[model samples]
Target: MRIKYKMVLLILLPMLVVIGAIAAIVFVQEKQLAAQQTLVLEESLLESKRAEIMDYVSLARTSIDLLYSSGRNDEATKEQVKAILRTMNFGQDGYFFVYDTQGLCLVHPRQTELEGRQMWDKRDPTGFPVIQKLIEAAQQGGGFQRYLWIKPTSGKETDKLAYAVLLDRWGWMMGTGIYLDDVAAAKAKISQESDKRIHGVMRSLAVTAVLAILIVVACAVAVNLSEQRSADAKLTAMARRVVTSQEDERTRIARELHDGISQQLVSTKYQIELAQFQLPESDENRAAQQALEKGLDGLGDTIAEIRRISHDLRSSLLDNLGLPAALGQLANDVAAHTGLEVRVDVSRCQHKLPDTPAITLFRIAQEALTNIVKHAAARQVDLLLSSDRRSVALTITDDGRGFAPEAETYAQSGGIGLRNMRERAELEGGSLHIVSQPGHTVLLATLPLSEAG
Candidate 1:
């Protein structure tokens, strides 16, 4: 992928992971909290139901208090109490029941057919002994028990909550119960509402994540556009600088030829004419022979000067002997001209670089040496070249009064030479780095050689 897309993924992947984790955490926590809330609400409602049933049982007991407190254990008095309880009921599915200590049904207001039947082994759908547990609760003083029973209104087995008490003298267990399908219905409603709320929260989180991703993508696009524009501008400027530098170099070479070599050639021509004029007399005159020799010597010096200028324009050594030799000759020339200590060290390179990379490194070295001569006030310069299988590197070090590598002038002012060197390295898929302290400066350039072969 392109760098911008890679950058977007780099930013977005982590964000997506974190968002997903947070959403999962929120969902799990909310679900747990909802379950807990439902449990608390169910307990509260069941407690209220227990209280209501207990109050009903209390009222029934109050109604029979006079009879029971009369110290009568006779069948007629028991029959009268049963008649009163059988008629006292709160709702369609609410009624009283009575059983003996042996688990024999005595009074069942809702199901009269169940009266006078043995109920000791009667079990609910879940195998709970309904009559046995209710009789036990009555025997052990008044208490509540939960079981399934036939609801009077629906005539279906439904959950029921009951309170039971013992009439000890009568040997009877009296109880009343309320059907509890409403509690189950209430819990189902709560669960349904909780699910709806959770879905709303999840939707909100999903929307937020999408919006966040969109915002990040938009920002990345904006940054990419801005960087592209800036890079284009810099490339244009660098192109202009390159053209200007080329023109300036041509102009300088032209002027040098005009002012130095052209004048010397003219002088040599005049001397040759003088030698010709004196040549006819050379067999008879020693001065004529001397003039001819002087002219030839002058011609030789002019040829050497021309060769030097040609070498400066484009080194023949670089084309014929490769980069190492060219750099060594350059070092020699610089040291000879500037009277500065210049050293060149080249390691045995196993890989030969292609022309562009070789020339780029050479030019970088040339620029670095020029900078050291003009600005660094250096006494000694070292050029080191080494290569591996993958890349070639050139490092130039100077023992000099070094300037700040981070100085703005190198980018903003008359520092095109440094910029040109860096641009050259980069154009060849390489890089240039400079490090400088008070009395030491180093310029390093590296170019990859993988594509050279």
Candidate 2:
């Protein structure tokens, strides 16, 4: 993938992970909270149901207060009280029942077949003794009990809550009950609504996370496009500079040949013509012989100068024997021309370089040496070439009166040469660097071996 896409992913992946974690935590916490709220609502509804049943039982007891408070223990009075209770029911599935202390059914408005049945051992589906528990609560004044019983309306076993009071004079337990199915329905509705809200929140979070990732991606793509344009501009400028540098080099060589070599050839040709004129009067003319010898010497010097210029244009050693021999020959030529001590070291380099990098290194070395000869006035110079499996490096160091590399004057004076050398290395996917102080200067160029043919 391109760098921009990679960067976008780098930003987006972590955000997605964090957002997903937050969503999960929120989902879990919301579910727990909904469960808790449902429990609280169910308890509240049960409490209301308990109070309502207690009120109904109190009203039934008050209706028989006049007869029971007269201290009567007659069976007729108990029968009259049972008749009133059988008719005092509030709604469908709501009523009161009576059981004697000996567990005999007396008043059961909902199921009249059990009016005189013995019911002491009656147990609910979960092994709870329903009549025994109600009697126990009534014996201890008044209290409540919870058990399952068949509902008249639905004819199905369901949870029920009852309040019971003891009628000591009649030797009976009387109580009323309310089923809890409404409270369960209410709790289930609340839970379903809570789940809907939670789902809505999760969807919103997902949309927000997607928008955030898209924004990051768009920004990365914009920055990448901008950088690409800038890089293309720089490449164009560098290409132009390279063309200009090549033209300038050709111009310099042409000027040297015209101004220096052309004048010497004219001088040598005139001396040869003068020697030919004196050769006709030979034997006694030592001056004519000396003139001929002088002409021959000048011709020899002219030929040597032409060969030096040709070598400068392109080194035969570089093409034939490789970079090491080329660099050694360059050092020897520089030392001979300038009387400066120059040493070439390739002892630590065994890897051979391909043409592009080899030529780049040679050109940078040539430029650095020319700069050193022209500006650096001290004694000795060293040219070191080293290589490893991955890359090759050429370092040129001089013990000379160095100038500040960053100074405006220094950069302006030799900026073209320095830039040319740097550009050459960069063109080969390499780099050039220079460091200079008062008595030391170093120019190092490095190129990758991976680009080699």
Candidate 3:
């Protein structure tokens, strides 16, 4: 596992996860909406049927009322009631019949067996519950109600929605009901859509996962032999042992010269300057003495420059004082060395974030400011590190003669410096932004705060 491919995995896996999650969410929402639309339309149609039935019953009641009042037990009233019963086929397993409290039938269209034979002791087996409800509503006033149904003929069950009203004082109930079969049919359609969406999303996810793996493998191949080396290219692999070993070596070398030869040379330079300053100046040795004095002066200057160089190369206090102290030292040193005024506000971040994230941020700051010092010719810099309960952001700004970042040189020239910074941020699920104008360049990095323990 070379680091580049691992870094590639670190980059692409999260993308796949995000795309998958979004697709799943969209699929679910779309199915729910489709199902909802089906149910709404179904209920609306059933309600229309219910209204038509109620109107039919109203006309039947009016027709029967006219028959009773006009003294005609005639064919016109019976024929009109029969017309109303025909519209109820939409309620699949439902029916309609009209009877009086005197145990007599006014109209029972399904009662070719009982149009004239009813004595009103009969109760509807399938329609009684709904009829009883309508009777109660008519007895009370007008209102909305519900009933469940199972038709003996169709053998299908339904949840019914209906509205009821009083027809008259003749024990007649006029009302209409909506069938829920349409609701079930719509649910079936939604179920099919859900199956389709799941299949599609899973197929996409599978292809994406497979593609990511292949891309990594291919990238690992392309990344190989990137630098030609005597028919045997030496490469750094992205494995645990190699990166860790490299870091250990860097820390060791940085510590040695900082603590060892630098201090010794500084002490030697001090002694030579002291001896030269104390020598006599009146002898023929005066010119030689003056030369020794100047030599000592040059040695002192050389010593100072070497120490400065060593300090810049590595900070011994980084390992000793940890990241926060190291960052403070870096800021101070940059201001002192570059002759730029720097204001660093890091109150919300007195401790390191997650160890790896902290290291990444530190390195980013180091590289960015180093570039500013070397090339920006900036005068003032502002570094802000603010943390909340969730995330922390580090921003570095320099008031320098900023250049156009739109040009390809901004990244291509820096080679892996910018690329490495980007990789660090992406690996940790964060982002980086760069903005530059005539006299200002700002670089910002953000990551979670509480990862360092």
**Top model by lDDT, which number?**
2
For candidate 3, lDDT tens digit of each residue in 1-453?
A: 887867777766665676678677767776776677567656655654564455444333433443333333456754554465544443344555554434444544333455555443444445555555555666687555666654445655556666655545435444545556666676677678767867886777678667756766676433223324622222223333334554565565455545664465567557555655765656654654655556556556655665665555455555566556667888898888778787877777755456556666777788888778777889888888876657778899988998775555765555245656766676566788888997878888987655434
In order, candidate lDDTs are 0.78, 0.79, 0.61
Lowest-sum lDDT 10-residue window in model 1: 282-291
What TM-score does candidate 3 get on C-alpha atoms?
0.42
Please state every model's RMSD to the true fold in angstroms: 47.7, 49.7, 37.9
> What is the TM-score of each predicted model, taking all chains together?
0.48, 0.46, 0.42
**Candidate 2, 1-453: lDDT as tens digits:** 997778888877776897899799879977997898788778867865775687578657755654665567888988888899999987789989999988899999988988899999999999999999999999999999999999999989998999999989878999999998887788889889889968987998889787777778767532223635865786677675655565455446545554565565556567566645655564545544554555456565655766577567667677688899999999999999999899999997898778667767877778788888899996899999999888999999999999876675665566356766777777767888889986899988999998343
Residue 209, candidate 3: C-alpha displacement in angstroms: 22
Model 3 / residue 145 / CA error / Å: 99
Q: Looking at model 3, which ten-residue stretch has the lowest summed lDDT? A: 230-239
* 1-453 per-residue lDDT for model 1 (tens digits): 899999888878877897788678868876896788679768967875885687578657755765676677888998999999999988777888999999999999889999999999999999999988988898898888998999988889999999999988888899998888988998898788878877987897799778878977888733224645865786667665654565455446545654665565666567566645645653444544554555456556655666566566566667678888899999999999899899988875656667657666776777778778888899999988889978899989999998877676864444456767777777667888998897888888988887535
Better of 1 and 2 by lDDT: 2
- Which residue pairs show backbone clashes in model 3? 2-238, 3-238, 353-452, 354-451, 354-452
Candidate 1 clashes: the total is: 0
